[model samples]
Target: MTFDHNPRILFLYGSLRDRSYSRLLAEEAARIIAAFGAEVRFFDPHELPIYGSVPDTHPKVQELRELSIWSEGQVWSSPELHGQISAVMKNQIDWIPLSLGAVRPTQGRTLAVMQVSGGSQSFNAVNTLRILGRWMRMFTIPNQSSVAKAYEQFHDDGTMKDSSYHDRVIDVMEELYKFTILLRGQADELCDRYSERKQKGVQESMSDIGRMVNNVNLSQM
Candidate 1:
């Protein structure tokens, strides 16, 4: 199916460093997504503070929540730190809860994960982020990318080398596009089933109240 209407994809890069390979990787992925006709945005994590029990209205938190709500899919790029996802990536995930007030920020959305490694190609970071995607109840696609020896994989101008890693990024973005189109309209139906059940219970309770009032009138007569 055609993912028309300009499906939005939010790219979250783990490291805030000026020349972070992960950020460069994410930008490359975004370029591919745009090439395939999707609107992609890379979020700047500099303003996002650590997660806490704060309300959804907090400025940076709200901005993130808004982007998550606006997008049909996401791309998470992080450097592998100690064989796992970096702290920056984890913090961004933590800041985005399953819900923001009445809306579920991640549910019914699609995700693709990528990682940049200091050594050889490693899937550790992407794998961990996939687990987190499941935890957030997001539909994560199967295709992923892990760039090995990231320093050598990218140019000084922030464009990544045209290699197998680039091809995988293209594959993941295309897959995410396909999955997002298939799932977008179902979001409300999936979420509202719970609300429908709650509505039914509320109606039944109101009916019980009506019955009690009828019985009281009869007793008074």
Candidate 2:
């Protein structure tokens, strides 16, 4: 399918540290995607309330949902902590519901996963994110990035230092942009499922029965 507008990409980073390398990496990816002619936005997890702690009407929750709905693709960057993806990352993902009534916010979107490691590079975080992306029904790209010794890879100003790691981020973002372009206008047909269609048909039938029942009751009254 073709798109008449620039692709919309949302970036989510895991880390609350003052010098969070995950956030820095996401920022670098954002710059790359923007240069690729995509419109990008970032969700600051610090402003978000813990999942299940607040109602959906909460400002941060609403903001996140709105962004997800607006985005055609996403980038998830998390730090590897204790040989796994950080809880901060999990919490952010948790806040995004798998479905909102009949609308699936994340389904059919393109996803790119990245991770930052304090020590030697590891794919733990990205691997976990890929699983989550699959669970969310996203079309995750084959390319990913895992930055080793993340502290040494980013400057004090949060800009990524010149290195192969930086190059990988650009590659990931480029792939994401291309995927977003390919998937944007086709998401509905691409995500369509027979099961969901059957379920919806059942629901509509039940609704029609309910209305009929109510009308009969009113006539009897």
Candidate that scores best on lDDT: 2
Please, what are the lDDT tens digits per residue for candidate 1 over residues 1-221?
A: 65458888999999988899989998988888898788987778897877785665789888887888888899999999999998888988888888766788888888998999999888899889999999988888988988899999887899978888778888888898888788878866765554455577766555666688777856556
In Å, residue 84's CA in model 2 sits off its true spot by: 1.2
List where candidate 1 sits over 4 angstroms from the true fold.
Answer: 1-4, 53-56, 189-221
lDDT of 2 by residue, 154-202 (tens): 8888899999999898999999988888776788898877577667775
Best by TM-score: 2
Quote model 1's TM-score.
Answer: 0.83
TM-score of every candidate relative to the true structure: 0.83, 0.88
Give each model's whole-structure lDDT.
0.85, 0.90
List the pairs of residues colliding in candidate 2: none
